[model samples]
Target: MSIEVSNESGMDVSEEDLISVARFAIARMNVHPAAELSMVLVDLDTMADLHVRWMDLPGPTDVMSFPMDELEPGGRPDSPMPGPAMLGDIVLCPAFAATQAKKAGHSLAHELALLTVHGVLHLLGFDHAEPDEEKEMFELQNSLLAEWLELRRQARREAQLAERDRRLLGKAGFFDA
Candidate 1:
């Protein structure tokens, strides 16, 4: 999967982290390998303009999704491969999302991760218009985020362990210093 991220918001947000999160979301959801995703971080003004033009809303939202080719989740390994497609664009307003992160008592990175997952789901045809739909979509979103975070933590722990082991080996004259 290819996830392109453009940070034009003029914020100090970590572009690498955003790209990693998008790649994780796409991979966990089993999206097609050839599917392309574009994530753009915009200023509030740009987000507001898009919010108005596309959604007819009056204010900038945290995130908005514009799907190109409607693609379904590839849940199974043997599932018939989907042809190359544009997974769509996920427009994020980092300036607006910062307020949300403060309100939610979480880091900006956390909020962005959640929003990224939400946007990807929207592109995959998930909606929360109804109560039941909201429950289903939110539950799935939360679960996906939780799982992805756990995976990240595990990877970090493993990396730390490997480094420690390497250090121990080096001290024991296991390799040329």
Candidate 2:
């Protein structure tokens, strides 16, 4: 997928990390590889204003999505015609996410990662208003996130092991340190 990420938050989040999360989230939705997504990382005030104007919610939420070309409810979407399909924009508030991360005892990066996934799910037309829908949607979201996280953890472990092996070889004068 083509992911366009713009940071208006002035926060210190790594752009590469943000892009990685966006790509992972969109991919988990089984979107076409040619599909596109836009992400805007904004501060709390901007997100709060958007929340008030668009959603009419009181405060700044971590993430909000505005999808284009949404399919009808209960209708499965077909992949785009080998071209770019605009999935939607996900506006995320890093300030709000930091506060929420503090409250939830997690890193801000992790909170933003989760929010990105949540926003992408919204773009795919997942809602949790009713009890049954809530159960279904939350379960799916949680399971997908868990699986993705596990994969990332495994990749990190492999990378660390490779680094350690390289360091050992360097110490043995087999290669440059």
Candidate 3:
């Protein structure tokens, strides 16, 4: 998938991690491999303007999704053949998300990951406007985030082990300098 991320928030954030999480979410949702996605991290003022103009809200929101195409989960036997698509744009306000992260008792990175997944879901036509919809969407969002985080943890553990093995081999003169 072609996932592009641009940080215009004026704050130091991990662009790499955001890309990773977005790719994972899109793949998990069975989006086409050729699907393209764009994520923008904007400052509070920009977010507030978008919120007011698009949603008619008063203040900045954590994230906002503007879907480009009507896309559904593909790769199923009954589903249509997967093909290229422009998923949409996800605008995130990190300055706004920081407050939410504080209340949620998690790191900013974690909160951003969750928001990224949430934005993906919205792009795929998921909304929480009603009670039932909210439950289904939240459940899926939480599940996806949790699974992705676990995968990251597993990768870190594997990397650590690999490094340790390499160091041990070097110490024992098993590896050529």
Candidate 4:
């Protein structure tokens, strides 16, 4: 998957990590490997403008998804081969997210991660407009985010262990100076 993340929010957000999160979410959803996704971090002014133009809302929101080809997950046996598609764009307001993070009692990174997955799901035809849809979409989104977080934690743990082993080997004169 081609996951591109651009940061124009002027905040201290982790662009690379957000890109990884987007990639992980797309893979988990079984999107085509050639599918492309764009994630943009914008300031409050830009977000408010987008909100007014697209959603006709009054204020800046946390995240908004504008789908392109309306791609869906592909894992069914009867389904045809998954082909390349432009997934869509996810516009995130980091400034707004920070306030939401404070209210949710989590870090900005966590909030962004969740929003990224939520935006991806939306691109894949998920929505929360109705009660049932909201429940299903939110449950799936939460599960995907939790699994990705666990995977990241495992990767960090493995990296730490590998570094420890390398240091131990060096201390035991296992390498040349």
Candidate 5:
């Protein structure tokens, strides 16, 4: 998957993490490996403009998704043959998300990650307008985020252990080359 993230929010945000989460979400949803996604981190003013123009809302929102192609979750026995696609764009406002992060008692990075997953779901035709729809979408979104986080944690642990082993070997002159 080609996940491109552009941070134009004027705030220091982790573009790398955003891309990683997007890739994880798309892969988990069984999107084609050649599918392309774009994420933009915009400032409050830009988000506000987009919200007003697109959603007709008054203020800047946490995230907004503009899906291009109609794509359903692939890889099932009866699903369509997976192929390259333009997944669409996810616009995120870091400044607005910061307030939500404060209320949610989590780091800004975590909030962004959640929003990214939410955006991905929307791109894949998931909406939370109704109660049942909201429940299902939120459940899926939360699970995807949790699974991605756990995977990241496992990777970190493995890297830390590898580093520790390397250090120990170097100290014992076992890695001399």
Candidate 6:
């Protein structure tokens, strides 16, 4: 899928981080390369305004997804005839996400990654408006995020281990001797 990411509100988020998170989500979900998405990094005020307008909520949220396609007549949307569909916008508030991450006791980047996955799941027609749906959707999100974060953690661990081994070898004169 095509994930078009922009810092429209000058949020100072790294494009590298966002793209990596998108790549992880795409691989985890087995989404096709042609399925399109847009992620907008906005300020708290923009997010708060959007939240108020869209959900009738008064405060800023970490992330919100506006799914593009609605069920028409019976089946899928008209646009995605022979290819993956264009999912809609994911508006993210970095500031709010940072605050939430502090409360959640995780890195801000990690929290944002979770929110990104949540937004993408929404575009895939997953919802949590009902109790059962909420359980299913949130449990799925938690599992996916936990797996992803653990994968990253293990990879980092392996890399660090490799680096340590290399340094130990060098200190032992294995390379020089």
Steric clash pairs (candidate 6): 1-32, 1-33
All candidates: TM-score: 0.90, 0.88, 0.95, 0.93, 0.94, 0.79
Best by TM-score: 3
Model 1 spans with C-alpha error above 4 angstroms: 75-81
Candidate 5 lDDT over 75-136, as tens digits, reads 33454656646889999999999999999999999999999999999999999999999999
Ordered by TM-score, highest first, the candidates read 3, 5, 4, 1, 2, 6
Task: State residue 127's C-alpha deviation in candidate 3, in Å.
Answer: 0.3
Candidate scoring better on lDDT of 2 and 6: 2
Model 4, range 36-138, lDDT digits (tens) per residue?
Answer: 8899999999999999999999989999999887465863345465655688999999999999999999999999999999999999899999999999999
Candidate 6 per-residue C-alpha lDDT over 1-177 given as tens digits, one digit per residue, 9 for 90 to 100 = 577888876657776667667667656666555567789999988999999999999999988998775422122435546345666788989999999999999987888888888887787778899999999889988888888878889989999999999999999999994
TM-score of the candidate numbered 2?
0.88
| RMSD list, candidates in order | 2.7, 2.8, 1.9, 2.0, 1.9, 3.9
lDDT of 5 at 156: 99
Model 6: how far residue 143 lies from native, Å: 0.4
Runs in model 4 lying further than 4 Å from the true structure: 75-82
Q: Report the C-alpha displacement of residue 76, candidate 4, in angstroms.
A: 10
| Each candidate structure's count of clashing pairs | 0, 0, 0, 0, 0, 2
Candidate 4 Cα deviation (angstroms), residue 60: 0.2
Model 2 whole-model lDDT (C-alpha atoms) = 0.81
What C-alpha lDDT does candidate 4 achieve relative to the native structure?
Answer: 0.90
lDDT for 108 in candidate 3 is 95
lDDT at 43, model 3: 99
Of candidate 6, the 10-residue stretch with the lowest lDDT total is: 71-80
How far residue 111's Cα lies from its native spot in candidate 4, in Å, is: 0.5
Task: Point out where model 6 deviates above 4 Å.
Answer: 69-82, 168-177
lDDT by residue for model 3 (13-93), tens: 999899999999999988889889999999999999999999999989999999998777863345465654689999999
The model with the greater lDDT, 1 or 4, is 4
